[model samples]
Target: MQHLLLVAATILTSDPVPEDEDVVAGWPGFVIFIGLILAVAVLGYFLTKQLKRTEANRKAGVFGPVDDEEPRDPEEPRS
Candidate 1:
């Protein structure tokens, strides 16, 4: 138990040494980050445009006639 305690104290007192100081996210990483941002922006813009067009088409009754009837309860029998 005395030898184990001594070994633990030595390990706890040692300083950590870094292997490399030069490793970093350089120009390639920055370029890829910018690319991902642009891709998400473009996709969001297109999605909004498509949704607006679909809403306009639905209002124009392109798919079918719009129902003007009141919503019926599921418990009620169909007339």
Candidate 2:
């Protein structure tokens, strides 16, 4: 957990950058930090939406045989 925070802190650089060069430096840094966070959140939302849709499609019918053949009891004969 500590390592993960450290990496995030590193990615959100706090080194002073000139206002004129602020575009990429992210000036106060929180600017880009917030943007990056939002971007990830939006992507995550869309990803989960897709995942749910796929899971719904994969859901099995509640009242039908699972496969083409009828499910047989353990005691049923094959002969």
Best by lDDT: 1
Report the lDDT tens digits of candidate 2 across residue range 1-79: 9999998898778765668655564466888789899999999999999988866655554434344366677797754
RMSD of 1: 6.6
Give the TM-scores of the predictions, in the order they appear: 0.59, 0.41
Q: Name the lDDT value of residue 62 in candidate 2.
A: 43
Best by TM-score: 1
Give the C-alpha miss distance for residue 18 in model 2, angstroms.
Answer: 13
| Model 1: how far residue 2 lies from native, Å | 38
lDDT of 2 at 66: 46
| lDDT of each residue in 15-42, candidate 1, tens digit only | 5665687667799999999999999999
